[model samples]
Target: MRPTVLITGASTGLGLAIAKRLLETERYHLVLTARESSLERFAEAGLAPSEHVWLRPLDVTIPSEREEVIDEIEREGTGLDVLINNAGVSYRAVVEDVTEPHRLAQMDINFRSPMELARLALPGMRSRRRGRIINISSVGGMMAMPTMAVYSASKFALEGACEALWYEVRPWNIHVSLVEPGFINSDGFERVRWTELAHLALDRPSHPYHRHYHDMTDFIARVMHNARPTPESVARTVQRTIERRRPPLRVPGTPDAYLFDLMRRFLPRRLYHELLYRSLPHIRTWGPQAQPVMRMAPRAMR
Candidate 1:
């Protein structure tokens, strides 16, 4: 039997591109999951139903659904050879304005679900004596940003969990790798639905930080439009990571991701924080009114 690979968030973006690339190889059976809403888009994009690509409706944030998905995989009697945790979202919210519900949602989708999925998949992979877990993290995981505090925090947690799991599972011949992308073209931003508090923060009458919020949102909107790397680039990297005999514990994607990583390592903590604060218009000021969008804002780490 071919190796079975399960990829979360495969309905679009990097996950979808990876699925397409792997399908061309015909070396593995693929199981993919995304929200039910993505099916039409996937179909419209010309990905037909096939024995090679099995699509399942899953919102990984829900525990019962995750368990059911795993159970169905088990019942198929196909051993999972690789698990790619790529399902995540970033909410553009400041610390002060992020509501409890929104914060929980971000945490559930970006960090908690990945950990739970790994927890469920690891035992089976260990029993098999050979398996791989590739987590699709972001540069946001490595450093802090201005408006995406909650998102960054979640990714940070994910990075910690995966790094710790690497040592724990190495004895079982299960390779764990983290793929961190700087910015990829995805609906996570374009289709980002802000929470009520975020809306209030953006359009608040008494908002002390309105200008900062507006500037951050403007920068994010522009980045989403023009500054993203191709999903295919990320897909190729993920494929290479899986095929490598000695894949590193972490793989950084995007042009300057490695450079940024190095700088973070060598720079003084205060200096790094200062650079981040000064670079983002949102963090440099507090405001009572929405400010004009700045067109020359520098590209973020994403």
Candidate 2:
């Protein structure tokens, strides 16, 4: 029997790419879950689930929907061999610009849902003494950046939880891996979920930190205009992680992801911050008197 793999946010972006890659191999039975709108978009794009694939609309943030997915997985003959927590959103703005509800929503989709899914899936993994939990984190997970405060916080929380889970479940042969990718390109930058308040602030130049927000948005647009390391490549990393004898605790999905991780671990703090600030040149536009500084921001490290 083929291994059963469950992927959240499976309708688009990295999730869709991962699903297609696995479908090509025909090595695994896939459970692809995403929000209804995303699934509709998937269908509109001319793709549908095959015999080996089970597609469903699931908002992982909802406790009942998450439980339902686990229950279904438990009933399957193969049970669950892998769980990919790929559902996530990034809110663009300064810390203050994000409303409290939006702040919580970012955490809910990115950090809380993944953590809870792991908690639900672990019992089954432990009972069987085998399973793989792969989280689709980001380069921001390794280090924080300007205008990404809340998003970074969410990933940071996930990274810490998964790291601890790695040590605790090593004895059970339950492999946990964090797949960190850098800036991923999307259609109209759908992945960059700018908060409503932040959007409004863009037109109001009088708004405090307006320069910071616009500069950051322009920076993201510029970088994403030429974003590399396709989603399919990152998806392949997820598949490879599952097939490993002892899946690595952390898998940097792109070259920049690896660079960021290593630099943070080895580089001196002052030097690192200098590089960080230099790369995020818009961050220098903190004060009203500061002019927008736009050069080739750090391309590789994201």
Candidate 3:
């Protein structure tokens, strides 16, 4: 009997890439889920109905859907051997401009929903005495940035919970790991742009911290271009993490992710902040510069 693996956000970007990699292995039968619209992408990616794969529509933010996925897995009788919590959303606005609804939405998708799904999958995994839980987190989870407070907070919450879960589940031979990736050259930013918070607050020029938001956008775009963590690359890391006899607690999914992890571990808070700020010209404190939006909003953000 093939071990069953469930993957959230399996329609595109990292999720699609991971699905492809796992399917190639033929070692595990995958239960892949995404939004209803994205479910078709599985067929496009060659993950059609087969003994090796099962595709379903899942919006992780919904509680009923979470229960439904786990319950369906139980009906199969084999139980879940691996759970990949890959569905998450992110935006890029300063915390000052973040509405309460947006903050809760971010937490729900990135942090809470995964925890809830894990709660549903745990009983089967615990009864079987073996499982793998992998979360696709970000470097920002460890090192928060200026316009990334809300997104980072959600990831930080996930990392904290997973850290405790790692210790708690050791006795059951359940391995929990975080695959932290840096900025990737993927369409994920655009997919999440529907959120007002994800953009640099260029429209509201009167808003404080306008200059900081303006400058940081260019800085991150450049960083992503230089970074080597593509969706496919991260997928490779995820595959190896799952295949290992005793996987490490954390895996850096790209070179930049590895560097960020090192920086977070070795650099002082003041030094790290200084290095980051120096890269952006106008990203200082909320002083006089915040009163004006000097440059045009990037065409992408607009």
lDDT of 1 by residue, 1-302 (tens): 87888889888888889888888899988887888887676786667778777888878888887887777776784877889999887777678878888889889998999999988888788888888999998899898776778988999999999999999999998999999888665545655546666666666535665666677766766675675577888888999999998788889977657867988999999998888777786454555334444332223312
lDDT of 3 at 219: 67
TM-score each candidate.
0.89, 0.91, 0.91
Residues 138-161, candidate 2: write the lDDT tens digits: 888989877789999999999999
| Cα lDDT, all candidates | 0.79, 0.82, 0.82
Q: Judged by lDDT against the true structure, how good is candidate 2?
A: 0.82
Models, CA RMSD each? 3.7, 4.0, 2.4
Poorly placed runs, candidate 1 (over 4 Å): 282-302
Q: Which candidate do you rate higher for lDDT, 1 or 3?
A: 3
